[model samples]
Target chain A: MKGFLLTIISALLVILVLNVGYYKEWFQAKPLQYWTDFLKEKDDTLSIEGVMASRYGVAYTMSMRIKQVLEQKHVTNPVILFEPNSYLRDSLHLYPKIRVPEPAVFYYYTGLEGVWINSPDTGKASFLVRISSKGVGLDVIKTPEQRHQLLAFYKKYPPIL
Target chain B: MPFLLFIFLFICYLVAGYGLLTIFKMQLKTAYMITLSLLLGIAVASFVPFLLQLFYIDLNPASIFGSLVLVALVLNIPTWRRIIKEGFPAVRRSFALKPFRILSYEVPYLLIFGFFTFVSIWRCYYLPPTSRDALSGPEAIAEFAVREHTMINSFFNIDLWTTNNQFKSPYLISLQMICKIAGFPFGQVWLSVVFVSFTVFLYHALKERLHPIIAGLLLLLFLMTPEMYAYTFMILYDYSNMIFFFLSLYFLFGYFKSGIRSHFYFAGLLMGIATYIRSETLALAVLFLPAILLSQRRNKDSLAKIVKANAFFFLPSFLGYYLTAQLWIKYYLPIHYDIGGLVNGHLSDWQPLFQRYSDIVTHLMASEFGIHLWGYILYFTAFLFVAEGIFVRRYSRDARNWLYAIFVLYLGVGALGFLLPMMNLNETTKRALFKLLPLAVLYLANNELLIRLSQRISRWEGTPSYLFAREPRPAPTPIAPTPAPAKGKTAPTVAKAAPASASRPSPKKRKK
Candidate 1:
């Protein structure tokens, strides 16, 4: 019986030690941000966003809508991308519009794009989006006809799923 | 949960198998006990490291796996079976049923086999594949082989290449083939299979020659040591080379004992194969040739007879490597260009040979004796045993020869390491040397001390002499009784005299 107890204790201790070591990043690779940034600089126009939504189409639509809102607010950026909801909320302070209730109407700041806004009932923000300068609305339609035509075209094609 | 279940089932299988051996009369109780002890010892050792890892104490996988294999090999089992056949007449005459009964004269081996299997699997799962050497050397070779569909001559402009260069050992190629057949990524399982198989083979081979208890203990020592297990699972050339080297020795010894020349041929073939794995193993081949020649000379064999006997063993062995090397040289240089430069540069390094030797000695002593403190306890114990054997000359000639060979080989390898100026004589090499060193010491020690002690005690007191002298015996009756003159008259004096006279021999008879 004593032997059995000792075995169990030893096994548990091993499990605990392994769990701690894994969390402590003992096996983690060294920092590679510099390499990542160098690679990203090669393709200035392209922006990559990692998302974990259940539906790809929904996530795509949400990203496009956010991009459109930012453009309307005269936020010209090279790239505008939506992060996953879980990760976005985790870093809520880094993004503008604390509580975004609906997918279509995303509450964003006109002035400093990433300013926090609090909703009393709903609590903190739902998502955070990043916008680069290249993606801003530098080119504008002079007349209403151009804008209508652009919206019509977007409605027909829609964003990819 | 699945892993735990696996462990439990494995343990159960081992216990059951050992129990079955007992039921079948195939092994004695001592074998079971020794195997159990080995299993427990390994379990504890493995668990301790694992626990340390959990507490964020990271360790190199090579050290762990190497230690595990060493431990398993050290715990030896000594048991042989005698087969007895029994014919049952109750069955139909036409059937002629004969049941073979196995009478175990020593310890059980099946339990040991089960333990080996479990630990091998455990080591495979926990240890990562060789990421260091494999990522750099073998991977490049493998990729080139896959692209060309044939062996290449040079790697990175260095000649001395072969298509088989991608594989550290032919056994690794076989492992890859198995993974391929299973429709799995060959790289994923290749190293694990090679590592596990090498350890298993070593354990079985060593067990065949040594007593089970000693073998088990020695195996444990080797496995638990930091180097063997660590490298065993790594996709490096060294571990595989060591395996093949030991395997060659194993077959060589078998050939010597049985006079089966074929075993020698296989041993030579393995030695040849080992050269491709690590160029260093070539030294072993060189050493073995002279040893064989010396043995032949010692036996006083004729020159022609010796040549003929050795030819059978050397021909295929030489041809295998020669052909392979020739094919490689056709496309590339005979020697690897970088290797010469590396060797020379290392030779000119700053470290002194004596300093390196002392470092190696220190590490070896610590690993064996100290447990964790001094570590030299193991080395000291082994040294004591070998010394005792040398002095007493009590063990069998074969054991003495094996011990001497081990000592010579250990020193020879150490000398090679020392000669290489840049070679870091660190804890790792010391640990690797410990695998064979401690076992050799134990073998000599156990035979001289344990066996001799038993023999001495047996000799001091003769059997059956003391028991008979201490016990009382009945007196013998008289040979002749004087006739009673009067039947009623006191016949007591005559009867007593007759009995006394009958009991004692006459003086004339006694003198004669």
Candidate 2:
């Protein structure tokens, strides 16, 4: 009876280990599309920007979020490719700059023109963003007209997104 | 390369600590050695670099390596030879079948600990520093050190040193330098190894006093604690403090049993390291001194002898607190506030102070989330200690009873000292209670009522030997009866020494 109990426990342990593996994403080799779709479908519109990904997929969703946000703002003329977003990487690496809400990404959104957006603040709010396009403070988005000019400037960039 | 260096430094620390214990004439228990060595290694890493950095040397891999080499040459190498020649065989023998022959059942508790430990290690790799303190405190301190490649902090741009003076201690910064030297991003794997080793040590400590099964069960209970398991992967120094504080108590208990001066020194040194790990552990020095002195039971000793022993115990602890405060005072910003300020702040405003005290005490009793099961254990243990009084001799000797009493007193008093000054007592209570949790576990595991309850359970479960079971062989010589202290002339009976003072001297003078 004890041996039988031992076998049952061993089986249960194996099952539990496999379940842990599945939840931890250790087993399957899922694509970025799977995650992007999962995030996009998890919530409509703003959820793309809102959803926090696992630490491994932080860069992927970050670049994807920027792509989705630009698509929403009608800045479609430029090709947007985020190359590991050094500004955000460096910001996250910087101890004081990193806060409770996980800093998402600081991307050089290269389109018709390349822009460096330093989004140190990651929260429910979308208004507080630090973006620099063309030159220092050239199309800095402090107000609506500046936001439009920034988008218009990006609208001239080649479509690669 | 960085991973290899971390492993290398870790092994060097283990060897160093093991050798030191052997030199101190400790029994050389592997679990105890592993845990003690890891903590001592961290303290050494922190202190060595700190002294180097004082001379305008940059705190980097080269300096850290140089410090390790100096330590190895000075103390570790000679001690290592003695440890291998004399201690290795004894340690190996402990793992032989002789110890396990008496025990019948190996419960599933170990399996549970293994699962959680595996999960914690996995999470360390998978997760980033997400906890609030981790983001801005020790992890941040390490990042700053690595980025600058120096221990000197030029900018006080962040409020990192207000309540966060604990970070100014070079332990985390030294560790961070090691990690940077190794090439791994700052993760909890190193901390996880330390945490897991601590649990192993806790198990051994308990096993010495209680049934192996009970020890295993209690250890499992401790590991399964929600906050403790989470903090194992979280970059916080509090858990390490918890382990060191518990080890100090373990050594204190060993001293009480054998009356060995080295055991007392070990307790003192571990307490000091605990204080260095977290400033709050400074209270332990104040808490333990009375317990230790009272446990001595030696009234005939000269004043000089008493003072020397007291100095031996407290000097390390004072140094631990000093190492931490000195870093802030000399190099970085001065400590803005401490326990003294808290007392003065509360004293001036009695009404608010009373209100805060009432709220914190009430919350401690009712706290469900942070303190977890340990809170309930504390509540129950306090009740048992009060109700039991000094009427029963659950343990054989009065010194053992006094040691337990002092520890319980320390836990209760230490918990309040941590809570009284806090801005958010509710949020801080869990971590504050962690310092008390190990002591609470010891109390519960050894409580007369709990022992009885467990014996009943063990009988029903068909276990061979119950907790507190007498060995099959005859017991050792009972302590000799001696003159008791006058009533009201002595401190509380819980703080009194053994009945016989002469029995202690032989162990006191014996050299390794």
Candidate 3:
């Protein structure tokens, strides 16, 4: 038990050193620097939502924001057809690179149906997201012509991984 | 997080795992015993959700928790009986802590390991899974499984053509399902249990052969590997698959040393768990046969016995693939994932095999993976191989066998890439290659020069015993299928699969 306690003390010393390393940025990519930050963030860092915001940033917020817009329009069963990842990432020139989550992941976030451009069920899509210099905008496709036009425009770009 | 219930669940793991260990009559140091208890317990418990689903049991909190209590109760009968006969005092004496003598050299390493584990557990626990692999597959399925109280949920109603991840295995889904029902919404902290236990096991395994300082440094190198460290938090099949595959080999190594049938079967069981985690591991499990045959032949076993031994060693993993793929995926799920489509149709050319093998050598071993992902661990292992080749005159049996296992993993992963179209270079093959590091580290532990240096260090420190060198045990009875306990007697043979309990014998004799 004495040896175990000494071992703990030594470990504590090591932890102390790591905290110092992180504080000083002694090593630029110092190991467990986030751990020190996580420690000080104990109270503020309680929810997965905050972590998601920090990690996914615009991509996460943009999807959720779209979800809110759909809900406000009473679109209970939304079939979202998203712009191709290539267009969103490259052509749109979104800062920090918007990594468009796949349809599966999009569905995971919003609990709504999502289909990429080449998806077999893209014809079932009821909504289209168009990105421009103004901002990300969602449009309700009232007819097959509108949906097909959006699909034709999006397919001209590329597909999401 | 329902902290109390989580604590209760862990206690259940300890009790159930301790029971299983007693059935094997396995003994170990504190770290190894506790670690294996959690791992073995979690492995056994992973099956419960599957069985419940088979019987059409609800995957709700009450039913899930109830099943855990039942399984824990059932698995613990042997240990309970042992306790009933011996009384608490004797039991306490048996499990008595060794006099506290923490080596000064071991402290910093312990701290560093503790720090890494903390970061890992938090990221795993406090956040929703960020990996597309999990989100698109296991995490998505598990989230709905909790809501609907069934594995067949609305997530299956969506587009799944792009992936066969849902068809892979129920291992993660089952564990995550249980964790979510238990209280954790993310259902991934069980990974933390595995990470902590395996790290402790690996450290001890290394420390037995190398000095504490050297073992600590090697472990630091291992844990610091960026991708593997990221996996310590991320929920993925490969991480668990790597741990079990390594343990299966570690046990197989023990079988080679002790000629114990139980260790062979136990290794088979672990390999089965690995296969349960990833169906493709069945193919890799088949790769272990040559090593087993070589080891048994050197043990001078008869051909028939050797065949039977190999069968015992492989049957669980075969059954693992069979139950998960052939039965469950074939019949149970609502969706049909084209599993056969994953096989390569271009088998005749034999071109891709060499191509993939070379690509694995160049892309995985030399470039981005070696630098950014693995740090210097692989390089260090390669350097050790070169140094040993140049300087060391002879290899120990353990070193030789570990190198064989490394050879098996390297080729097996490359072969898997060629055979399975789903195994992309950047993902499946890259992760499958994680299996080599543990084997390589174990090889480093057994390296003759390191052992000699470790012994020298022990001598310099005035320790009574050399670290790696062991006093041979009085030969135990060989290879009985000792499934049942012998009327309060110990299991047939002690495999010494673990270290440090052998540091003293009588107390353990009474304990066992």
Candidate 4:
């Protein structure tokens, strides 16, 4: 009887905690539906690139979602590179001679129109994003060369996502 | 499909581990043996492909699965027989949830274990593999292994061979490779399995020696340890080697306590695996050799008997090293160190070596991740053991000496840490010291001094130090017959014997 009661209590406790964890998004292996919805509002025309973001968390997840969305939308030859701390790496084919600017808080993402979005805080998303030195919404790429540059640069670096 | 594969592979590992335990006749408690079996399962699974690749066998998923099936069938014949004979009592016992008998007073310890278990699972699942050495070593090699289903290194883009020492041990990379073969992305579950195994085995080992409440308390201290908790999730060979080290000691202790041949065999197998896990564990041979010799108490003067018994102890480790690590180090290592040169020529730099030792000692005493008060108690008791072993000399050897032997072996490794070049002495030394923590805890919990101290403290507090004031045995078994003391020599009073059993014949008598 004692063992039975303890088992019941333990089961209840585990179920309660698991429910709380799932509600709070504390569990990993986020569903494909979650990822799809996460990138559903992303700008289709704008190519995205990032530096020094987490490999498994935001950057990797977001990049994979972008790729998934591009394929779903039937976009041709889309580039979505999100290599963390690549600016510090020397083995990349692209940016061999170019100066790779180091980010302040270890994340740097920018669209084709130079609209840079980065988190000032580590391990958390930052809503106050900047385009160069000014704030901007998710904007469209103005020129074909800019889109081509994003694709070409990512083609050279080729993130592992 | 991948998730199902993960579950299937996990079940296969458990079955294989259980089968191996039965084949070896290791009489661990049901829960304890389950953990041990799982560990053995993975080791055997990884080693199958590793051994086959050496024999030029194709190592794709189909071939590896076939190998696993063949091996399982052969081992399970004995296991199935044991089940039929024992009527599946142990299996039923493993699942039979019992009330925590000491739950009233030991709520804190239970809570701590609960929190640590939850954290271990949470860390493994939620925290992705992100360690730098992880990417460069096992993950990189595993990627290559997955792409090309052979151990042959043609597909590897990364220069793991020419540059890194991380790829030297086959256990970690082979584990990742096996995970890929099992159709999972990587074996993230491996670390958690090992972590829990170490904890369960430690509990069983201590519960065998001390009271259950005391064992729980000491395990709480272990879980509270910073480096241990941190590395519980990280993909490093340090914890893997620590598990092998703990199991080696466990079997060696059993060998000495029970004077059993099978225990010696198991110890040797574990030690060999330890050496394969980390080359540094080769130092453990120093501790094991003496124990193997001494544990064969009746053959103390018989050279031939001693040699034969020690052979059983040495053979498995020899196979463990030659099969995996020695093969990798010989052919794969880009820049092998001149070990003889390092030992002989490097002794001149005494000042720097001493400095590194000092740094390691200091790191062990640091507040964060340090076992707090228990750490100091362990060190103080360890010093007393050193003095007793050296000065008294008449102290008859016991299972506690097994702990002392390991303590001394760790000291040698700690000092050797200073001489190695280009290594981060602080971080490397700190991690190395974590291995020493469990050994020290076991020693303290079982030592005569600590037992007396607990008694004294209990008297002062007007309460028992341990909830149960009886000698704790993990399983209900007969007390092993005490060996007759050698003529003109007194027996070691400190020796802790296992439950009742007829004493095996002395090695000399066996030879006759």
Candidate 5:
């Protein structure tokens, strides 16, 4: 009887191990998906960027793209005033349908500073992120007038989470 | 070469840990000694780099490695003296190797736990520190510390308005700095050491309470808890905080059962370590104080002796809190943070506290969505609790004690929300509750019904020696004949630690 009980438990534990992803979510992806994706990839291309790209697929790409634009444009200590998640996601229907990550996360990904409309220093932003019917693009505020005008318009939307 | 360096550093940790435990002289099985020493060793060595920074010493590899050896040597001074006095080989001979007698029932649990552990370690190794909490706080600080060779690196000059991670304890910072300097770029493999050691220690602890099969089953459930398991790899303070806090309570329970002073101090040291990891733990440490103060028998132990015992147990955490706050925040960081400003201002209002507790129960504990978050572990606990209430109608001493600790932990985290308004429900309260799971598992292990079933299973398997079956030895006259706790055979007393104070010296001085 003890053996029977042990066998039943052994089987149950194995089943749980295999199906861990059924309940466990790592981020946007299930844990099983992450495992499958991780195991399939070869380690021949090991780098910090590769690891970021692997864990965060599209969100990472967008951050790097913005970073590329900033570096090419020679914007130093780039402070980006971000459009709210409701506007960016619902209005623009952003690719991947994911809301914009808050400023700290953005800062973590790309060393450039990010600020939401509700940020205390939000109006002092050097660059304003604007969304058109086409897609998301970085809008450089050349003067205090443009920064103020943009902040006034952006404040109408819901605060980015 | 880096792998070799990792191994070398680990050996230093082992020696340091072994020495510390040797000084304490707590009687534990070889397995407990080894695993606990390794974990404690890692924790001890983590402080080295931080201490160097506290003294304005550079954090280069050469400085870190040299300081490690020096610290390890200093910690093991007594042990080395013992070895010299009693010949090294004879002292070594005393430590006879005890092979782990793994029964057939334990095989499945071990295999799966081993597999998951490998995955966790690999992920931790392969990935950089990308968690928002770490990157924003400790990891960012560590990266710059390595580059600049100081804890007060350039990471702090930037505006850190969105997160207050900069103010966290330097425990992770110190270890991450040491590991990064030692060549593990991610600087998180130390977590792997902690994880493996804790699992072994917890499993051994559970086995002593019930049959291996039942223990294994409960542990397997704990291992499979979805959200908690994610932390095994993820670099966070909560996991380590939970381990030390639980172990402290375990030893505290032991002291309660055995009437041993060493056990009392050992429990304090663990709580101190936990407090060092997360300073908020110092507040939670007070909840267990009532248990200690109340444990004194009426009129037998003097008020002075009782107060001294309570102070000794609470002192380590106070020291730990001091090291965390005064050294790290007040001195090390180049920023001004109002510690008092972080406290919730509306203390008179009970509404927020009630709201905080409601969210904890509705969203984190009993809600259907909670099953998705924490899986069935909470439900399993609730089920066992109901079963015990209906059928058994009796609780053992340990079970009763465990339930008290679990409630203390639960209400403690909820109270933290009231105390610190910044502590959110999903992240702070949710993760802090990870400490509660093991205590609940212990409660299950001590359940009368579960113990009874485990006994029946063991009897069927032809094992006579089990929990509650052993002959009661005569109460040997203890140093203090303070009343033997009315344990009611509930606590699977793992051999009452015989020598209370005569055996081990008081805190630091060699002999009493």
Candidate 6:
């Protein structure tokens, strides 16, 4: 009985020492960060309107959807800037020149290229989006009037199946 | 908790495996006692260093010398008779004759060998071909070989220590050759094969020399060592060096028993190969060469014969790498050499040596407590065995003195080389010591355990009656028989000794 108690006491003391030592960083566990869970929770309904290079491969699909949304809002003859022979077709062919009209609103999506919204006073409707076989997501930028115009246009067109 | 449980399970399995091997070898009791003693020994040995530290003493010269003296005292104790009387029956029962049936003997070896082989294959097959270290030095050489489509010139240009341009010793290159032959995808597989083969060879070597129980226990202890096991799976030169070191010992023992010149040659060759793998093992060859030369000095053989023997021993190692280097230089770069600057830099830093040594000893003692402690515990146990062996040698004269002498010489040289006043002890020194440790522990434990058993047996059996047979026998008397015997009664009579004394041998030949 005495031996058993001694064994128990010794075991506990060892545990305490280990805990203290570890807590004091005599031994350390490596640092780890997980980002996959955050990416999975983002909203999917937003759409972008921008000129995307077809040569950009999968990055063009989002640009096309944004172009279609602008066209439905009667914003025709918007200057398209995309790389030539690029897989992303909406990109302009000219090199080193991206023309933006006055009062243009810049929309930037730090998360996904396609799922962003922006509005500005510029006459040019400039959008940047990424397209992939995964599907079309959106990023949009517009003034309050432009947004109202886009909502009314969307209500009329309703999203074709 | 799960990790702790896993470690516990692993230890239990090792103990159980050792026990099973002993029972199979018909040495159940020896196995049990050895396992218990070794585990206890490891704990005791690890603590001794710490205890010494309490006195503010340097562990180097003092602890080693003191441990040796302490071992000597422990060996001379007169407790053998009591131990033998109590322990022998249990030993005999444990090693019952049933396990040695011709078919049964092969089963355990085959099973163990096969299991380790599978494990090696699994580990190797899964190795990522391009690790960060691999991309730089040894792997860079391998990569260069693949890209150039030839192994010829890779050796000269590649260096291991500086910017992946270091010249790795030929050992890892040989393994790489195996990987190359198997195709790049199976590169890791060859390391596994090497690990499994080395381990199996070590197991057999120990088993042949000592009791099977001891061999199994040694194997278990080795496998349980986290650092050693981890290296076995990784593409490292240490594993190969460790293999060759054991192989050298195995062949040396074979040479001793058979008086085979070829065995000595093989032993020297293996030692040389081992030295190439790790420069520190080169110290071992210093002891070996002298022992061989001394043993042959009294022989009447011609000088040419001795030269031939030495050549046979040394040529394989010298020529094998020389030829490889020649080819490599001819095809790849002009010349290959180690830039000694990095090593010299280490030598210049003196403060870490004492600190690291202290830290290593402390970690080793605390390792007995749990998961993080495994490697330290194994190392400490080895130190204990060395201590015990040193103690036993005081009484056992016929014990392998030459081997012990070599061990001491190697340890001294290694310590001086690694811990020179100019050279700070670093991770490199620690790693080198770790590699040397397993074999040292095996030798120490085997020697101490055997000595104790022999002493105990001697005490219990009165040193065997045959040892005291030279004394003369008492003279016999003649008796007269009665004229008639009663019905169903037998007469008692004494017979006189014959006068012929020619049948008995002289006392000189029979003297102990």
The candidate that wins on DockQ is 3
What's the lDDT for residue B80 in model 3? 76
| Per-structure clash totals for the candidates | 71, 5, 2, 8, 0, 54
Q: DockQ each candidate and list the results.
A: 0.02, 0.06, 0.34, 0.05, 0.32, 0.02
lDDT of 5 at B93: 37
Across A1-161, the per-residue lDDT of candidate 2 in tens digits comes to 54345445444543443344222233122222334444554454433123224442433343445556666777644422221223433433422222112221121111122222222111112232332232111122345565445444434332211
Error of 4 at B441 (Å): 1.4
Docking class of 4: incorrect
True contacts kept of 2: 0.02
Higher-ranked by DockQ: 1 or 4: 4
**Ten-residue stretch with the least lDDT total in model 2 chain B:** B471-480
Chain A TM-score, each candidate:
0.25, 0.24, 0.74, 0.23, 0.72, 0.20
Q: Tell the DockQ for candidate 3.
A: 0.34
Expressed as tens digits, the lDDT of each residue in B1-512 for candidate 2 is 66677678777676556556655555444455557667666656656666666666787777768777677456556455655778865444322333433233334556556766766665564445556555434555555666666655422332222234334466665665666566666445667667777777777656644555556656655654555556787767677777777777766665555455666787888888877776656765676666666666544345676688778888877887876765455445433434444553445555655554555556654455324434234454566665545544444342244346445544544355434655345555456556666776766555555555445545555554333432110111112221132222231122222222132223333211
Per-residue lDDT of A88-159 in model 1, one digit per residue for the tens? Answer: 344434223222212211111111122112112112222234323233122333454654443343333212
Q: Extract clashing residue pairs from model 4.
A: A52-A85, B226-B369, B478-B499, B478-B500, B479-B499, B479-B500, B480-B499, B480-B500
What does candidate 5's lDDT look like per residue over B1-512, in tens digits? 77988998899888888777766655456667778888888878878988898899988989989988888888888778878888796335324456747777677777767766777778777777757788778887787788899978766665567678888988899889888877888889899999889888878777765677777777777877778878887888999999999888988876665555666787899999999999999988999877876666522467877788789889999989999876679876888889899899899999999998899889998876677667777788888888988997877566788899998987899999899988899888888988988898878877767767766767777775344221111111122223333232122233442121122222232111
Give the CAPRI class of candidate 6: incorrect
Q: For residues B1-512, write the lDDT of model 3, one tens digit per residue.
A: 56777898788777777677666665555666678889988887788888888888888878887888888888877777877997675345434566767577586887668877888888777877878788888888888888888888898888775566777688888888878877887788889989998998888778666777667777877887777878888889888999999988888777665555666787888898899888888888898777777766665677887788778778889888988897888888887766788789988878898999998888888875456667667887888788887897667667888898888888888888888867888888889888888988988887867766666666665563344553222122122233443233344344332332253234443222
Evaluate fnat for each of the predicted models and list the values in order: 0.00, 0.02, 0.36, 0.01, 0.20, 0.00
DockQ of 6: 0.02
Q: List the residue pairs that clash in candidate 2.
A: A78-A157, A79-A158, A79-A160, A112-A157, B2-B182
lDDT accuracy of residue B364 in candidate 4: 53
Please state the CAPRI-style docking class of candidate 5.
acceptable
Candidate 4 regions off by >4 Å? A1-161, B1-3, B80-102, B153-155, B159-163, B181-183, B297-301, B332-345, B348-352, B364-399, B422-424, B449-512
